[model samples]
Target: MRVFAVAEIKFGELDPVSIELLNLANSIKGDGTAEAVVIGNGISKYAEELAKYADRVWKIEDSSLENYNPELYVDVLSQLFSKEKPDIVLVANSSRGSEFAPALATKLNAPVITDIVGLDTSNGIKATRYIFQGKLLVDILVKDGDTSVFTVRQGVFKEGSEVGGEVVDAGIKPSVTPKREFSQIIEPEVGEVDISQADIIVSVGRGIEDASNIELAEELADALGGVVAGSRPVIDSGWLPKDRQVGISGKTVKPKLYLALGISGAFQHIMGMKDSELIIAVNKDPEAPIFGVAQYGIVGDIFEIVPALVDKLREIKG
Candidate 1:
């Protein structure tokens, strides 16, 4: 059972998701050797870093790869896979990894699984992913084929993974330089809250209504000493930054305490946060799906309910 784990990094060093993959690859196995594929311009040094954690590190350096151009990066990896022919591939369920994993799966004629929370290697590398907003855990197994690739969901694996493993350099062939020039990449500015890492998160949704109403949610979050997050409408309507959106289209989280304020849990919104430990929802609609998973449910409008709750929280804190 040979595996090629794909890890990409920016700024410096492998990201948290890559470290998670390394820890996973280091322990379990399906059949063959475990190898890592890293791509960057001067990624050779980082290749040495990964070697301390992985069995082997394959390197691809192209000037065009200084920044991510999906087309160019994909072309490089595709060429490498054709030559290397590893059996299983693992990647993070990140933006690029999600976009690229299916494309690679299509190219290799193998099944692709996304947002995997657990792996059942007991039966030939089967994985478990949430279906129906984590209401059920589905076990997935890819039939024997050219290569099976997995893009893991962030925060599923345990933390405190150290970077230390063996080193093998894959001196991969360079591709034609990409003609397109990347001028400026604009990244959205977001405040600090690794919501995925937070044990408690209090998120406001469209039900909060006005921009001023958001302060109530913030007060609640502060009283709980938890980070504040929100749904798409809450963010898109300029009630909050886009970074705070918690939904299928936004960042996923796995907090120990998740408080839903005025948000009707649409399946898409629920998908991103369903991995939370304990969910508490405050919504006027008792029929809202948010109530389905909410350990504690309050059926009321945010306008009346939040202030009372805030007072209670402050009293307790005081």
Candidate 2:
């Protein structure tokens, strides 16, 4: 088997999920070859970094790829894969990766799976993904296909150790005329903290009652030496900034400790923080969906429990 993992770049740096994809590819390659494919302009450093983990790195550094264009990406990858004919192609389930995986699959006449959380190749190739809004996991076998493409979910797989490999220059230039033009990248304004990188996050939801109650969560987060985040409801209600939002439509985080205060555990919200190392949910409703995935559950009102928790933490610290 020959596996190829695509690298994703964000703000001129290699996205962390790219490494996760490489790790997954290496794990399943067994006696076969595991390679990485990177497309960008002047991304030699990224390619070099990937070479440490993959058996080989196919670096396609072209001026035309300075900015991401779905059409151009599909065209370039399709041309390459048509000739390479890799047995499996792995892409991150990120915004850009999801956009191009299906197009590339169509070009290669291969089956495409999105948001895959697990894979097994012992018998044939089986991929596991969530169905019914993440309420259930369904395994689908890739039958009757020589090539398969999968967009892997982030934070599902463990990072693997690096094995030195060689970096090969693909030297493919763009030939497709894209209907869309590249524009300047628009980045959201950064707040006092970047929740995605936080070690501990105390998140709020509609159960927070009002904007003023957000201060309670913030105090608890401060006491625990963490940061404050929120679900879409809290962000939409202006209780927190857009950068603090955690959900499917917001930022995905994998903090060491995630304290979901008053979050009802909607599928969208769970998608963002389900990968946390330790999840502790506090809600008055014992049957809230958040408890389904939480490691620790506290069925109580946040308005009353948060103040006590903050006081306890401060006492422990002092």
Candidate 3:
């Protein structure tokens, strides 16, 4: 029951999902060992950090892999897996993971599953995945002798605490011609506040309605000494920065207080913020799904509720 977790690094730092994959591997290892593969140029620097969660960390450094190339990643990982022949392989269900996992599975002649949210080794490698746009969950089982590759959904697993482990520099630099060349990464314009790090987040959605109305949410956030964020609708409407968007397509946040305004609470949105310690939702429709996970629910028009809430907060402060 050897488990191999693929480590993904961004901007010279290990992506949070990479650690989550290692944690998931630890849970299902079942007396077997867990290891991680760190791949990229100069990424060996992170071997010590990854070793905390993995029994063994393999640093696969290569100048060509400094930037992620799906073709190159699949090629390199395939070669490594061929010799390692681990029982289970875990990768994050992120943009990079979605692209690399299936391709790697094909090369390795293994069974691959995507967007898995739960894992259970008690029943011989069974996993829970969502279907019908995340409305339903179905358990899938892999027959014996089938090497399993999984693209695990982000934010679904907790990251394990740092522990002592061994680091091994595989010293495997793969040389292969790629049809595509690595290119420059385009970054979004920076904003004043990184909502992901904020302790309290006031998130707006289509219920905010107009761009000018964002000031209302901002006022509420200011009163609470928090930051303003929004759902995809607000970002797509150009009312909020992309970094401030909260959902699977956006940033996964675990703020102490998550105040959702006018959000209908789609599962994608829930997946990101459901981990918040306290969630308060205000929407005109009482049946909005946001209320499902909310600790407090206010059924009313946000336009009317926000102003009153802001006034009370200001009064309390005075």
Candidate 4:
């Protein structure tokens, strides 16, 4: 058994999703070698960093492949796989991974799986992913061929912590021209605090209603010595900046304590913060999916409940 894990990098740093993929590959490799494939300009150092976890690292560096042109990436990787085929390939379930994996699988004529939360390696490769807003877990198996491609969800598995593994320079350059050219990357304005770094996060959802009501949640967060965050709905309504949003498309936060106010739990949102140590959800709907993973649930109006809780906390602190 041999595993080939693709690594993703952003802003000159390797994304944690890549490390998680290595960890998953290690878990599933029963006495098999786990190798890593990293692509991009100036990614040789990252290959060395990944050497700790992977048995060997395949560094694919090209001037044109610097900024992620999907066509070029697919063409280049397909050429590499033709010469060195592995039993299993793992990719991160990120924007680049989602876009690249399906096309690569098509080129390789292999089966593809996305957003896998669990893996059952006992009987072939059984992957588990959620359906219906995280309410159900569906397990899928690949029976088509010896090679299978997977796009793993972020923050689901812990990153591998080993170092000093060997590095294999793949040194293959395909003569492929892309129809699309690389462009500049636009960055969002930096906020006072990054929610991903916050230990205690108080996140609001549609239940907050009016934009003015956000202050109530903010006050509660202040009293708790934490920061304010929101679900996609709150950010979509412009009550909070995009940086304060927590979800799959947003930021993934594994805070020490997470307080959800007025947000119904969707799988996309849950995927970001499900690894949080303690989750407290407040919603009027008792059947809200947020309550399922929450350690504590409050079924009530956020308007009435948040202020009361804030006042009580202030009094206790006084």
Go through the candidates in order and give the C-alpha RMSD of each one to the true structure: 4.4, 3.1, 3.2, 3.9
Error in Å for residue 309 of model 2 = 4.5
Q: Give the Cα-based TM-score of candidate 1 against the true structure.
A: 0.73
| Residue range 168-284, candidate 2, lDDT tens digits | 988688887899999799875654665766789999998988988888988998898899999988898888988788876677788899999989999888988999999999999
Residue 198 local lDDT, model 4: 78
lDDT of 1 by residue, 15-57 (tens): 7667567667765654545677888787777777777667677
TM-score quality measure for candidate 3? 0.84
Candidate 1, residue 104: how far the Cα is off, in Å: 4.1
Q: Provide the lDDT at 224 for model 2.
A: 88
Q: After superposition, how far is residue 314 of candidate 3 from its true place, in Å?
A: 7.3
Model 1 steric clash pairs:
1-31, 1-32, 2-32, 51-165, 52-164, 52-165, 53-164, 53-165
Rank order (by TM-score, best first):
3, 2, 4, 1
After TM-score superposition, the amount by which residue 174's alpha carbon in candidate 4 deviates from its true location, in angstroms, is 2.7
Candidate 1 segments whose C-alpha is farther than 4 A from its true place: 11-13, 23-34, 42-55, 61-64, 75-84, 98-141, 152-163, 190-194, 222-225, 232-238, 284-288, 297-318
Candidate 4 stretches with Cα past 4 Å from truth are 132-135, 192-200, 216-228, 232-238, 241-254, 264-275, 282-292, 297-318
Could you give the candidate ranking by lDDT, starting with the highest? 2, 3, 4, 1
| TM-score against native, each model | 0.73, 0.84, 0.84, 0.79
Report the lDDT tens digits of candidate 4 across residue range 1-318: 688889888767787677878888888888887889988888878998889888889888888778878898888788878888888899888778899899999988899998787776778889988777656779998784868998887666664557457887788775788788877986555546767667899999999888999899889999998999988888889999887888866777878899999999988888778889999999999999999999999999988899899989989999
Single out the weakest 10-residue window by summed lDDT for candidate 3: 188-197
**lDDT against the true structure, each candidate:** 0.77, 0.88, 0.86, 0.84
